[model samples]
Target chain A: MNETLNFSEHRMGKAIVLTLQGRFDAAIALPVKNRIRSLAEDGSRRIVVDLGKVSFVDSSGLGALVAALRYVSKDGGDVRLANMTVKIQQVFTLIRLDKVFKVYPDLESAVDSFEEY
Target chain B: MPGRQLEYSARFGPNLDNLILGADLVARFREETKVNIKTGDQIELAVGEALSNAINHAQAVGDDAIGLTMTVEDGMLTITVDDNGIGFLPDEVPQPNFKEHPSHGYGVFIIYEVMDSVSYDSQNGINTLTMKKRLEE
Candidate 1:
C-alpha cells in the first residue's frame, strides 16, 4: 500500500544503474519515467534498472520501462532489467513484456551483459 | 458450492491511493478466503488495474467518488469499479500492441488476462466494470 517509489542510482563502469523500491504503479510511473529520461539526457545511455526491491508493477510501470527503453535506444543504448521478483515476472509474462526487455536474475549479471557488448 | 460469504464496498476520491486501497481489499479477501497465492496475486493486480483506470479517467463531477465493491460467493470472487467519468465503449478501446511495446492500453488487457470474466456497463453517468475469477480448491 506504500505509494512512495524510492529510486537510487549507481554507476558501474559506463552503465547507469537505477535501483527502484516500492510500488511502481500509476502514481509513480511518470516520475520514474522522467528520471530515466533525465539519465538518458545526461549521456548515460546504457542503463540497468534494478527491481529487486520493487514489490509491485502495473501497466503504467511497464509503460515506464518501455518509455525508458525507447528513450535510451534512440541514443544507441538500451535499458536492461534485473532482479525481478517472481510476482513481477508473472505480470511481465502475462503481458508478454518479458519478450520486450532483457531481464536478468541479478544486478551483477545485468551489468555484465552490458559490459560484454 | 456454498461457503461463508463476504462483501465489502467503499467510496473514495479519485486518486492513486484508492488504487492501493483496492489492492489491500483484494489481499484481505484472499486471506479470508484462503485462496492460492497465484490467484490472490491475479485478483490484486486486476483490481488494482481497474481502480487505476477509474482514477485516470475520473472527472470532477461535484464530489462523485469512485465506488468499489468486492464480493466473494459460491467459489467465485467478483470486483466492481464504478466511476463518474464519461464512459467509453469498452469494445472501442483498442487492445495494446504487445509487440510494439505500448504502455497505456495494457490496463484493460491485464484485467482480462487475470479475471475469468469481465463486463462493462455505463448508465446515468456511472461507468461500472465488473470482473470475476473462479477460486480453485
Candidate 2:
C-alpha cells in the first residue's frame, strides 16, 4: 500500500487552498498534520481546505481541522472546508464540526464565500 | 522525528468508554507524529473504533486494559492495538469489503477504507491488531 498521504497547495485568489487525498486516519498522522500546520505559516489568513479527493476521515481528522482552524484563526483568518465527500461529510455531521467549520460545495464557491464574509 | 517510535499500553475495563480513551490517545499521537491536524482527528476516530471492537469482542474482560503503539519509520507509520480477550479465527470474522457486505451494513468495511493496511493475529490468548498507512510519498 502507498504510505504517503497526498496533499497539494494552491490559491483561490488570495485564499490558500489545500487539497487532500487518501486515508486521513492514525496510520498517516504526522505527514498530514505537518502539512496543514506549515501552510498557514505565511502571512496568509484566509485558508480553504478541499476534501473532494479524500476517501475517508475519522475523529482524528476532525481534530486536525480544529487545529488548523485554531492556528489560522488566531489572526482573524479563517479555515474553511470545501467539496467534502458524502462519507466524510457524515463524519463531520456526526460530531457537529460542520457547524464549527465553514463548508462549501467546491473550491470556487468556498473561496468566493470568503469574499462575501 | 520522521523515524520516531511511539508506544503505550492502555487498560480496557468493560464499562470503559473506548471512544473517550482512544480519542485522548490519538490526540496525543497527532502532536507526536506532527502530521496534519485534520488527519490526526481521523486517526483518533479510527483508533476509537478499533479499541471499541477489541473491548467488546477481542477480550471477554472488555475490562482488561488494551495495549497500543504507533511507530513512524521513514514516511511510513503503523498503529497497533492488542487485547487479551478470547480470539476468533481471522477468516471467520467478516472482511470489511464493500463487495462482501454491499449496503447491508459495514463498520469494519469503513475501517478498511480509511486505512491502507489492516491485519490481526491471535496467539496464546492475545490478539494483536495492526493498521498502517503512509504519511508522504
Candidate with top DockQ is 1
lDDT of 2 by residue, B67-133 (tens): 7677777777788878877765544667533232221123354456567888888778778888887
Docking class for model 1 is: medium
Q: lDDT at A112 for candidate 2? A: 91
TM-score of chain B of each: 0.90, 0.76
Residue-by-residue lDDT tens digits, candidate 2, A29-117: 44555676787676778888888887656555566677667767777888889999777886676555755788898899999987865
lDDT of each: 0.83, 0.66
* Cα lDDT tens digits for candidate 1, B18-77: 567766666677777888888888887887788888888757244447888988787777
For candidate 1, what is the lDDT? Answer: 0.83
List, residue by residue over A11-62, the lDDT tens digit for candidate 1. 9876889999988888889889999999999888889999999878888888
Model 2 error, position B85 (Å) = 12
**Quality of model 2 by C-alpha lDDT:** 0.66
Winner by lDDT? 1
